[model samples]
Target: MSIAPNQCTVFVQVWVDVNALAQGSTRGCYAVSNRSQQSSGEGSANLHTNVITSSNVCWTVLPIDPQYTGDFSITNVGAESGWEQPPAPVAGMPNVFTGKLTQSTVGGSVNSNIQFSFDGDNQITVTLPVTITPVTQ
Candidate 1:
């Protein structure tokens, strides 16, 4: 699917504890924030988007700690008719993801999760919950 040049982009900053993650401890190893700066709270943030028919939106995942190098995979937890199937990570740009608002009769929302896995000695996966709301316009 081709995305518009001016498509709205949502940025999700991933905070990770490299040491803890490497040690296979996911307790407080992962957190997601919409802001570029780190927050005291640990967990994912709700991301809202306003869209028109065929509107394209992109999600970019940025790991706070550059030391933690791993690919991110996004999964839709529930089906939302207002949005087309979410796109996979852009090839060569593993951190970038895209989704398009559908022309459904009704606007809907969906809960999605992104998993960041480390291919290091200890394979650990951290899932960040995200809420996607498509507002029909």
Candidate 2:
């Protein structure tokens, strides 16, 4: 089940909200794995090899809270691995961006909305619900 150009191959959404961390809010980690190679469990019996065209792949993140304003930095966690950061626009296969949220400080709970756009208008938004577990130190 190979995906043709302008075709939707796989759609994924995930929620992550870590309570505790080793290096406060300045240090943490997040990771995105490879998309499954199997096609839809139903329909076609043939297995689809996941291939990101790079040109068609993109990942974007935005804070759900309009008032919340802080440094929302992302880093490439997978270096030795083949996985890398998403390329800037004007570039093609869909790409995946994965990294931990880095900020000077974060208080209370917050939410982040992630969107993966493909085939122009076709897209998906993955929600990340963040909850900072209070620590007594």
Candidate 3:
């Protein structure tokens, strides 16, 4: 049996309310990572040459095909964007944004601090655990 390093990871979060309109012990929550970016500023800039490195840059695990309609803040992120924070994520694995990917740690968890404001009595931020399975040829 050969299980080739087959499993790419991605992060997904959804948020929703859970009370007053009882739907069970759970509610729809959006996945959030503290590494989420703030887009109300500059685009990617090369500090070495002081030029804008424009490309599809995502700081954290954001839904590529976003289903919800709202605005998110992608904050001060630069060359060292995409990283989860101090005490890093071991070796070999870079904390940098790897394209359209949000890591779903097998033996750990990633915490994202997302801000939410709604016009309802129930409010909560949920970090959804998304699974990624790599396909083989």
What local lDDT score does residue 53 receive in model 1, on the 0 to 100 scale?
A: 48
Instruction: Compose the digit string of candidate 1's lDDT tens values, residues 1-137.
Output: 53432465434445556666677665544444343232234353433333344655565554556766565443322234556755445556555566665655444545444565655665566665654444444
With candidate 1 superimposed using the best TM-score fit, by how many Å does residue 85's alpha carbon deviate from the native? 4.7
> How does model 2 fare in lDDT?
0.25
Q: Candidate 1, TM-score vs. the true structure?
A: 0.59
The full ranking of all candidates by TM-score, starting with the best, is: 1, 2, 3
lDDT of 2 by residue, 7-125 (tens): 32233222122221211221222322124432221111111223332212223232333543332322221122222222222123233343222221343211222332211122222
Q: What is the lDDT ranking, best to worst?
A: 1, 3, 2
**Cα-based TM-score, every candidate:** 0.59, 0.25, 0.22
Query: TM-score winner among the candidates?
Result: 1
Evaluated at residue 26, the lDDT of candidate 3 is 31
Model 3, 16-120: lDDT tens digits are 433411233333333342223421111111111111112122223232334543332222222223222211121232222222212223322222233323322
* Collision count for each candidate, in order: 0, 11, 16
Highest lDDT: which candidate? 1
lDDT of 2 at 1: 22
